[model samples]
Target: MLSSVLRSLQSLTTHNNEHQECATPGSSTARDPRKQVLMSSTTFSGAGPSVGKRLNIDGDIPDPSHQLPALPSNLPPPNATYEHSTPPQIPKYINAYSLFLAGSIEMGAAITWQRHMAQFLHHLPLTICNPRRGHWDPDSRPQPSDANFRTQVEWELEALSNASVICFFFDVNTKSPVTMMELGLWAHSGKVIVCCGEGFWKGGNVKLVCERYGIPCVNDFAELVVEAKRMLKQKGLDAVTDEEIQRDEEWAKGIVARKARKEA
Candidate 1:
């Protein structure tokens, strides 16, 4: 009976050992090479305590406060400052040279009118359109040369497009067919049109045309110049100053003196 009891006790001990081995994490299965390496390294290195135990070294971990303080429901209003600044004045000669001069080229009055206008507005640039010359042709091939009329008209239109202003010098005595067309084009393009002529010859048609198109017409070239200067000033270009006028007068006198000397 003692021998049987000893054998039974040994068998129970062996079964417990097998059970423990099966319960252990890696012992029952074929261990991964990497996992085995890691375990062996940990054992040899005598690694510190598990992370959980290390983190809670002092006492039980405290839970965060259940009730969080409420944030402000309304944000503070923004503080902003705005500044208003004045605009700079326009330059004196803005778009001065880029002007188109249209009129009756055949008439002497038209020439005189154009010359006066040009002289008065010397500071501004001017391009005269002569329909009689026809268009600008470098080859110069075409009969009657008048065929080039369309070419001149095209050139004038191009100049008009580039111009800041279009001044029409109309003569009531010699009503130019082309002048009306040019004026109409200028009006349609919203160009500033300044018409100049004498009152002796009835300007009813011209006056009516200007009235219909809302163009400014003046009898005197000097008055036209004044008006043009005022218009330019309003647009912030060429503000009239007494000093500038005086300077211009002095310059004119010098030119006259030179001319007189040359003539003598």
Candidate 2:
């Protein structure tokens, strides 16, 4: 279904002559719903409304007082660090490496492996570009023309392009066609680390591509994390202060204490 929707969107871009003059020939924004420039805020909370909200098509000026708030700094650093379509309470950090989590979303049906990855690497200075929506309704069937869907695709593309490292995890439980497509897109970019489980339907194909491209491919999730860390360190981008690790430890302890109190 995703592949079909992508095809339809591409077809529209190819045949729609109305906005040809305004769009860049091969730019990512060429397939925009409005076929015009898209302006997004650089801040974590975003400059405009959250995903699923209407985009500002008109050239109306935003009110100065109606500033989008930044995510707070007290929330767990790992929780606050990752990028999602919607804003939630999270801490603020800078000089972070961007790691695009590209694989096996499966419309929220796939296990929340991204969170696990985030937790394991919580102490590292990384901004996780997670594509999974904070709030998604599995029942709703979004069309190719849906604003939310377009926004999400654009967001993921931009994130992947900007990421320092892109990690792909092909879950055995999912067909993961989109993940396969993403792997193909970045395989030659020399910035990918893949974890294709033994039972994945496309494991053989993935292995062949990884071999051809000399991309790091691991059969286990744990190995992927290790490779990611090694890559970051080799690039001299894995600088994590002792303060950050201590902070994360304190946060974990607080979480455990809160859970214990609630249970008692």
Candidate 3:
């Protein structure tokens, strides 16, 4: 009975060893079918490699370090048409003109001149001289009673000299003393003076001064711009098309000459 029990125990031990060998693979054995299926499904997809794994497929990913080279620094600046040995001289014969819109600061003529000048000749340098309390403050107020009026006058004279042309505006029905003074000053200084005054300004001090100084006086701002451009070309500071300049000059000259003929 004891020998029989020992044989039964040995048989049971051999069966248990066989079961353990089937449950766990040896070190050199291949992966199990379940593990191979799981790894293939999780690591390989149509969207490339899995998030954490490096892709092993042929021609699947690009190297990230290579990039296009930057442009060179010796390239010329854009929109540079010409390079001059010397700076182009400021047109002396009135390539740039300033407008001295002179009238009562609150008047319609002043407003009209400002609007038209801003619209038509916006590119030109214009200086409107209408002093007001708002423009004068603690920092830049003018001394009314100061005897330094000569200094102001000289400064204005210098501005006129620097500018190739000057323009003045006045209202015929209501002439401001300050406007008249400015017109007179520009006229006396021999600056190219163009005046835009009311139609009735024909037989007044403004008209008389314009006539005496040979200053071109017009009743319209549009006509004033045409005349100013023509004068610039006549003085040889403008190199624009001759046909255009001549057409404008003919129109202005016709108006002036006809007016003169009618007066005669």
Q: Pick the candidate with the highest TM-score.
A: 2
Each candidate structure's TM-score, on Cα atoms with residue i matched to residue i, is 0.43, 0.57, 0.43
Off by over 4 Å in 1: 1-97, 107-109, 124-148, 196-202, 239-264
For candidate 2, what is the lDDT? 0.56
- Candidate 1 has an lDDT of 0.40
lDDT of 3 by residue, 1-264 (tens): 222323433454465346335554433221322111111111111222223433222122221211111222442233122111101112222323343333332212123343333333333333332121111111211333433333343444454455545656543332233445456556755555554444432225566667777778766444565665555555453443477556656665666566558669
Report the number of the highest-lDDT candidate: 2
| TM-score ranking of the models | 2, 1, 3
User: How well is each residue in 108-142 modelled by candidate 2, as lDDT tens digits?
Assistant: 43555676666666655567777754653322233
Model 1 is weakest, by summed lDDT over 10 consecutive residues, at 37-46
Count of backbone collisions in candidate 3: 0
| Per-residue lDDT of model 1, residues 60-115, tens digit only | 21112111112223422221211111112112333333445565442121233543
Worst 10 residues of 3 by lDDT: 34-43
Cα lDDT computed for each candidate against the true fold: 0.40, 0.56, 0.39
